[model samples]
Target: MPPDYPYGDKVSEPISAYAKRIGIKHETVRTQCDKGILPIIQRKKGTKREVNLYALYLRAKYKAEQFIRDFES
Candidate 1:
């Protein structure tokens, strides 16, 4: 079974899988990860990086809440 995160979804997942789950392009997710825009877990040198889904979800939720607050103001 996949690891569970407190917020939702798996604790971590491949960029491609994450992009697919969120209905975005794999390249977009890859670009963000490459640019350090998204949280990731790199086990070791030359290993595949896994997107930190929990962190991403929290970041997105915070941003959305901020947007809503700004809009309400």
Candidate 2:
């Protein structure tokens, strides 16, 4: 097992924490990472992977809500 797995030695937060916090399913997060939309995971020893936290997703939920508000106005 990787020493930095689930929670890394450098980070208290794991990828799953952020993904789930952003309303993404854990499985979907893995799938998206595999599909290349998410950051390319770096292979760690003992089968763990690391994601880049600096990667920003183009969040559109707020935009869609604003659009609806504008349309209804």
Candidate 3:
């Protein structure tokens, strides 16, 4: 598990907290989730999105390959 995972190695995190942890704009995370480019799970019904930190780590560690595959598929 990543030591720097948002909220101390949480399996999942809210878009805002993830953005803060990674030092990016919260809206960007939200947009990515909304576009289904980021792996995410909805919390309950009508709640904000929660992203899988491990998936996010994999995506960032590898970068654009994920985007390319998603775009192609």
Top TM-score model: 1
Clashing pairs in model 1, backbone N/Cα/C closer than 3 A: none
Task: Estimate, for each residue in 1-70, the C-alpha lDDT of model 3 and write its tens digit.
Answer: 6665544657788788888978999999888888888899786889777888778767776776778888
What's the lDDT of the predicted structure labeled candidate 2?
0.57
Candidate 3 to truth, TM: 0.59
Which ranges in model 1 have alpha carbons more than 4 Å from their true place? 1-9, 60-73
lDDT for model 1: 0.84
Q: Candidate 1, residues 1-73: lDDT per residue as tens digits?
A: 2233354546799989989988999999999999999999989989999998778777877898999999999
What is candidate 2's lDDT per residue for 1-73, written digit by digit as tens?
Answer: 2432333343323558767777888788777777876664465655655455433322244566789999999
- For model 2, the stretches where C-alpha displacement exceeds 4 angstroms are 1-13, 43-46, 57-73
Model 3, residue 68: what's the lDDT?
82
Whole-model lDDT for model 3 versus the true structure? 0.79
In terms of lDDT, the best-performing candidate is 1
